[model samples]
Target: MNKQPQGNIFHTPEMFRVFDQTKGHKSTLWAVVDNDNCPLALLLPVHVTLMNGLLRQLTTRAIAYGSILSVPGTAGQTALALLLQTYKREAKGTALFTELRNLSDLGQPQTLLNDNGFAYEGHLNYLINLNRPAEELLQSIGQRTRKKIRKGLRDGFVQMSEATTLAELEHWYEILQKTYSNAQVPLADRSLFMAAFNELYPKGMAKFLLAQVNGVTAACSIELPYKNVIYGWYGGSDRAYSDYLPNEMLIWHILEWGANNGYGIYDFGGAGKPDEEYGVRDFKAKFGGDLVNFGRNVYVHNPSLLKLSKRGYEVYRRFFIR
Candidate 1:
């Protein structure tokens, strides 16, 4: 019997570069290389912080996030499978679970994930095609949205500015904090956005935008460029200026910016479920983007630990965060 040849496996430096450029999540990258030393597949595992308790341990998740490059055809699947097996073997006593959020259009990844013991969790995302001319793109938006944009400009005295300094970041983050507080949702640490802006702005991978009313900041957004798509990562508006429609203007400005910059698509980030009546989804739908359902895929290494961690996190969210 002949033994199968083993390919080279190691972490690439580019992973660190990516880790710095996006949402400030602590991440490590792993890749499977071919015999010729070319990378066939890449995996990025992110560390998620859960509640800390002595017998109830929480797990870190490995997310694909923005980039999940792979070779064409089944070679990618083979590389991913091999990487998962290696990860499971090496990740003993480390993380309680692992997940891979596949790219929106990654052929058919569920088969490979299922074969590797991963369960599927469906999610909805909205994508705006930016290949068309700006005029056509504007015309495609809902009439009410267009009116709101115009109203924001004409009545609200809204002005859009590109943020370039830490002061601007602080302003954007303050607005974010208010927005999250108003909604009663738990916001991530401010350090995450700060780190992301500090790293990605210099690399030209991210943009922080602010919409002001009469020189007062009323709305803000963070746009990230990955591959050929621009993602509207985070956005918020002042409820005081709700009648002015600052958010509508902010979104329209983002779309125009994407078109002018030659980006092929504008991702509205994640929407809610298909049958759900979510205000966020309804707002995104007015922009004339397509709704996609390429959900998250999860693979658990230790079911018992994962269950305990989830229950603990739920309690934390309900009592402490809320």
Candidate 2:
């Protein structure tokens, strides 16, 4: 745990400690403190092994925003520069590259990144303002979205919070697996989800919202509350109940819950690029939120190895893993 005033829950020691315990990802908290030993800036970099440690990469803490927090000024930039240099030196012989993925609207430190030889990776995200009145927020949503929520409610769908039982967790994981399989994408290991649910839910840092239809789980979403923002982390729906539109209902309920609980923002997580025609982005946009850009800042410490590792992973995915 790094000694600092508690601000963002994502930047907290308990969060990283849980990540270390459950996800098997090693995280190091780097900070620049003031004269009084108060942290002026902080960055959490996670170290991960690829291809069984044949290759390594230093990336921002998994499942959280990767922006160095500092007082509103050059302090952040200075700390970022120092952190980059430190990471470079530490990962010289170990990591192929280092990457930082910032939260939306947290603009990239272009000058510093450029000076440090970091490349820009653009992204888009949606943020639903929860400051407005609940009714006003509901009215702001697209008509189709509102209709879906209404239909789900009319159909007797109920929302459940924080699945505590193993059976519930297993059911949610099953839906997640199906969702990924249907999309033709590989599913992330279920352990990560379990770990978060087990560790953060009790502390009120995470919420697992489940939409049920006739006693059966129809849709579920995992949200993380950090500071005043509630992040829509991961979700999946039972395609069999798609007509009921449980997903729409789930999000609406989650938004209502967040608003009622005094959360100022509901982050729809990562959307695709602005120019891209992404269904996920379109779905998220219907809920009425601002689309913002704040993307990845990448630095290649060992370019040749990075390229080689990427190629090797692609080959492995195509021939073995996939």
- Please, what is the TM-score per model? 0.86, 0.86
Off by over 4 Å in 1: 1-25, 51-56
Alpha carbon deviation, residue 162, candidate 2 (Å): 3.2
Q: After the best TM-score superposition of candidate 1, give how far the Cα of residue 127 lies from its true spot, in angstroms.
A: 0.7
Residue 174, model 2: lDDT of 82
In terms of lDDT, the poorest run of 10 residues in model 1 is: 1-10
Q: Which pairs clash in the backbone of model 1?
A: none
In angstroms, give how far residue 142 of model 2 lies from its true place: 1.0
What lDDT score is found at residue 203 in candidate 1? 74
**Model 2 off-target regions past 4 Å?**
1-7, 53-64, 74-76, 107-110, 158-161, 315-322
How big is the RMSD of model 1?
Answer: 5.6
lDDT, candidate 1, 167-221, per-residue tens? 8888889998888777766676777677667667777767899999889999998
Residues 13-48 of candidate 2: C-alpha lDDT, one tens digit per residue: 766765565444566677777788866667776655
